[model samples]
Target: MFGRTKEPPAAAQPAEPSAAQPGQGKGRPTPTRAEREAANRRPLVPTDRRAASASSKEALRAERRRVQQGRINGEEKYLALRDRGPVKRFVRDVVDSRRNLGEYFLPFVLVLLLVQLAVSSSGNNVLFLASYALLYVGLIAVVVDSLLLRRKVRRLVAAKFGDEALFRTGVVGYAVMRALQLRRSRIPKPQVTRGQKVA
Candidate 1:
């Protein structure tokens, strides 16, 4: 039996358009899922190396500043343990609302120290005694003011919050410390102005 000669190998052909849209000529075919995804994808890394580095540094600095400001503002998550809660908020309000002699204690003591130095140099016994007495009185006044402020703040906290809030939280200590700080320098900055009623 004679075998049929093998047909010449067919040439590779380009992909043809589907019959559904045969009006088109030499047009690209609809993309497969992989092709579509590849087309839509973008590089996160910048093509310009130096520009990328500079932008990343600036972004990091800005983020750090934002976090610092958040801590300064007493935002809940960013706040220190001592600065958290409505109790501390109320304490800050009470301290901010009232005037305290303790705030002037440091400057007053500095002044007295200078006076003592000058008086000792001049050997004025009477002036030295007067200055010493005055300094002692100022110190006593500051201590008394701080104690009274602590009591008042604790009472207010208990009354507004509960008896459970009155003890063992170091709230009184916190208030006393804040009372001694200059008004402008208190951390979290005073939300209530002087002479304003504590809300």
Candidate 2:
């Protein structure tokens, strides 16, 4: 005899739900086609690194202005220098000498280089070595001359234009120089008012 197999009755089975239920699961509200299309069509805001830099710079500038204003308005302590008489004259002389050197230092280096080149031909290795040595010397001279010139300018401004005016001039000069360098210009002209004479 074969083993008996049993099956569940059809009347006892649970009925499956139809697909036409309203507000059912997995049917949450999604964006409308027009809303999605409009969102996609919206203009994108540009994000420039330069703009961020500019904003940071503006904040820094405002902070500096506040600090500078405090410094200007605050009472300052000073040491009496009644005996500092001949020292001023000596300092002025030194500044004048440095300014004169600044005016002529580059030209002097160029002339020296030309003379050295004229005396020795490119075929000579000694001449080449000398030329390089002169070039290095010229570079050092330029650095020194620039520092001296800046010092001289500071002294002149301090003597003639007062501290605040000197500071303004220095800031303007620095900005102009930076701009010119960025543009790869040879030299930046001094920012002077019309009818103002420069020494």
On TM-score, the candidate that comes out on top is 1
Candidate 2 lDDT tens digits, 75-161: 122212321233322232333232233344456667777867775764677776777787677667756655655565566656765
lDDT of the candidates, in the order given:
0.87, 0.49
lDDT of 1 at 181: 90
Q: Cα deviation of 64 in candidate 1 (Å)?
A: 3.5
Query: In candidate 2, which residue ranges exceed 4 Å CA deviation?
Result: 1-99, 112-122, 171-199
TM-score of each: 0.69, 0.31
lDDT of 1 by residue, 1-199 (tens): 3887888999989899757865666577878999999999989876998998999899999988887787767677777788888898889889989999988998998999999999999999999999999999998999899889977987898889887876756788999999999887777788888899886
lDDT at 96, model 1: 88
Candidate 2 Cα lDDT to native = 0.49
